[model samples]
Target: MSDASTNAGAGNGAAQTPVQPKMNILAQFIRDMSFENVLAQKGAKGETKPDIQVQVNLDARKRQTEGQYEVVMKLHITNKSKDSGDTLFLLELDYAGIFQVENIPDEQLHPFLLIECPRMLFPFARRIVADVTRDGGFPPLNLETIDFIALYRAELQRRQQAQAAAPATGQA
Candidate 1:
């Protein structure tokens, strides 16, 4: 057989072969959730008190992928007294979902999963945090809408800037 034909056959051989695999949401579960409304009761008592501050940080991680991916949404929330600057409470919640992705092109896969999927999950995760806080006894913590796409772009720019500013390594 000619070399060109032999190479073409080898390449086509893998294309015709079918691999057995399944794409399914094996489980969509909350890995962890922590809630603390330290001043909820204090505030609910209807007494005039010091001002309180609420801060939130959202994070995510992807676990080992066999056919599907387990994506986690981690929330770091804190409450503090604005006047005295004392920490009232701190809570970290990690919620996760098992997403099945198959037959998705590589170019579109990242934006779909990273941007779209996370956006879909954010509200649910936000609700859990807000409800937990309100039930804990303080004022309901209504988290502001986050723009993940903008945040991602800014983060990428920052990294590029940092890399560009760093001195190149070479022997003197």
Candidate 2:
């Protein structure tokens, strides 16, 4: 076989494959969680369609250990009655993960920490929401799949807008 075809010679002109990035979930935990059954507290509920809203936020910071980062996913869920406009339940959760990442470019690392790390931690966070709602005397809340790439883009846009407004507000 030719050296170029077999990639067996030092002088071969074949482009080398890029090194694959690596990430490891060293630990995951729930930093904080709260569930309030407002419907029960008010003692007023009878077969109303629930209007549910979920808000997710992500934060990441570097750890002392080399190539290690801590990412936190914060979830705020509110369920209100469609008929009465009263709150049914409120759930707030902060889930965090420690990840060891390697071989990723600095430009991409921020998005990877906010998007990919939370993507890995999502199932566990979803399950916790389901369990918490069910245990709190309501039907289980099965969260829909999240699009992390979109979330990351939205966050970038939000920050850019905020920065634009900051100078205008400062001048006011």
Candidate 3:
């Protein structure tokens, strides 16, 4: 093949390729946070096992600026004694980030926001949780890595089940 034809074919192939996803973090902050040391108030009498529970929720909204969106991660943590069923501590935190994104298809934006965006913010949120718990007069709480994809799928399944059940009960 001639050099001209070869260049033209390469150009066409490159043009058909999809653009890469782009994202920039404009800012990240803790929007709201609260920690309560229930054990301190109640007083620990003896050794007890800690039952810890963690819940994570994500939300995203568009900003006024073009291509700018805000993503928030809401984390709730609770600690209780397994032996006595006494509450040990409660932590609630809302961490948010301003993200400027490009090249993501409209159909994929929601999942990307809920999954990838929060995945980016998880380390910082985890650090905050550890700090707060330690400051509350307990051992530092090291959080486990979360699987955002699994969480999103479970949420979708939960919603589907609720919707499916709603119609069945409504007719009765």
Candidate 4:
């Protein structure tokens, strides 16, 4: 009787063990980077501060390995002289990370890849931008923190709008 009860208890314990969601970053690195000081000596000599523009974009794709995905965060920055409207400097960087994610529902996977993975990779990318700018004989260009959730939502809206417009334009 005690042996039967022990077996029953073990079965119940196994049923109660829950499968936990998991996300692990396997690796991260700068896939590509380019920095150009268009004006060179002229840019350094200019006393006036240039207007700076920065753009951020995110993309993700599944890797060959199961449960593995690659996410890339691309940053484009440009500085232009306020008075002369000449290009001062331009920098572009593509930073990526390989992540292993499991137990996530299909509905939540897109957000996890677009929002969470990029959030994890942003700081390192930001630091590299700053360092590259400083090393190029200019003051560090510290990027502002990005709002991934908002960006993701905006991207969705933009795509929806484009799809809605496509059929209308095709008929014309």
Candidate 5:
């Protein structure tokens, strides 16, 4: 084969990248969300003053086959009233997005799938969390923005440090 033909053949696959599936928002629903105010009535009456505290956590997982992925974002929330010592609320939401990934190099794909994709879906997830909390009868929760890339890097560092600290096992 001529050099030009050889080059053309080699470039065909690269040029005709696999057409990834379009991200489908098949389902966007709150998996689990709960609210409990132990002293709500008492606090409302001002009989018992309560200090409010809020805590949040984020988690995600990816499942891929061939050239498709299901990315899930789990948001866990807790709200408490201090003075009245009452449990205000607890919410857990699992929001997911179906993504199509194809023809991307491995190095770039990791970050894109792990960080960028989730970041894109976070706002919708946040809205769900806020709506659930508000509909449950409390003030709407405006969650702070999250840096998924930073989180991924921190998690990567943690894993690396853990591996380094672990005693080497004989079995490789």
Candidate 6:
């Protein structure tokens, strides 16, 4: 084939190929972590299981580098003695991951960042929580599987409610 025809054919083939969506986990790290035994020695004496409250929050922001974003998943756990209501332990963890995303449309990016990125980080964060609690003279805290989609939906609903209430409160 002549050089001109070959080049034209190659260009057409490249143009016809679809760009697949891609997500790459560049790095994962514990940005911050804290474990506190509120009662110290007194916290571990009880045989009863503690009432544990776990709260999860997530945030994502674009980085200066193209196609790169940072997602942070924060977990707050507070455990209290069931019988006496004394505080047992307070655990806080901020786990973050750097991701490179390409070819994903803007409409889908928000859900991907809020749900999928944090979902990827949760298992490691859960293991850390369990290990810290077990090493702190308590039973391992086995966190339940989180539903990221549900969390994302709830967050959206909450923000909508807040926005709705803001206008009503302003009128009063």
Tell me how far the alpha carbon of residue 48 in candidate 2 is from the true structure, in angstroms, after superposition: 1.6
- lDDT per residue as tens, model 1, 1-172: 6999999999999898875433454455567877665655445433334443433333434556644666665667777766655556666777676777676666755555555556767787778777877777656666777676876677668879878767554322
Give the TM-scores of the predictions, in the order they appear. 0.63, 0.89, 0.90, 0.87, 0.67, 0.87
Ranking of predictions according to lDDT = 2, 3, 4, 6, 5, 1
Report the C-alpha lDDT of model 3 over 71-107, residue by residue, as the tens digit: 9999999999998888899999999999999999999
Residue-wise lDDT of candidate 4 within 75-123, one digit each (tens)?
A: 9899998998888889999999999999888899999999999999999
Off by over 4 Å in 1: 1-26, 37-67, 165-172
Query: In terms of lDDT, which candidate is strongest?
Result: 2
Which pairs clash (backbone N, Cα, C closer than 3 Å) in model 2?
Answer: none
Q: What is the C-alpha lDDT of each candidate?
A: 0.63, 0.94, 0.94, 0.93, 0.66, 0.92
How much is the lDDT of residue 60 in candidate 6? Answer: 98
Error of 6 at 24 (Å): 0.8
* Clashes per candidate, residues 3 or more apart or on different chains: 2, 0, 0, 0, 2, 0
Task: Judging by TM-score, tell me the better candidate of 3 and 5.
Answer: 3
Candidate 4 TM-score, C-alpha based: 0.87
Off by over 4 Å in 6: 1-18, 41-44
TM-score of 6: 0.87
Candidate 2 residue spans exceeding 4 A from truth: 1-16
lDDT of 6 at 9: 95
Candidate 5 per-residue lDDT, tens place, 1-172, comes to 6999989988997888776534444344555555554445445544434343444334434554566666667766766556655666666777677676666676777667678668878899778777877787777887888788887888789889888767565344
**Best-fitting candidate, measured by TM-score?**
3
Tens-digit lDDT track for model 2 on 39-141? 8898875698999999999999999999999999999999998888889999999999999999999999999998999999999999999999999999999
lDDT of 3 at 24: 95
Model 4 C-alpha RMSD to native: 3.1
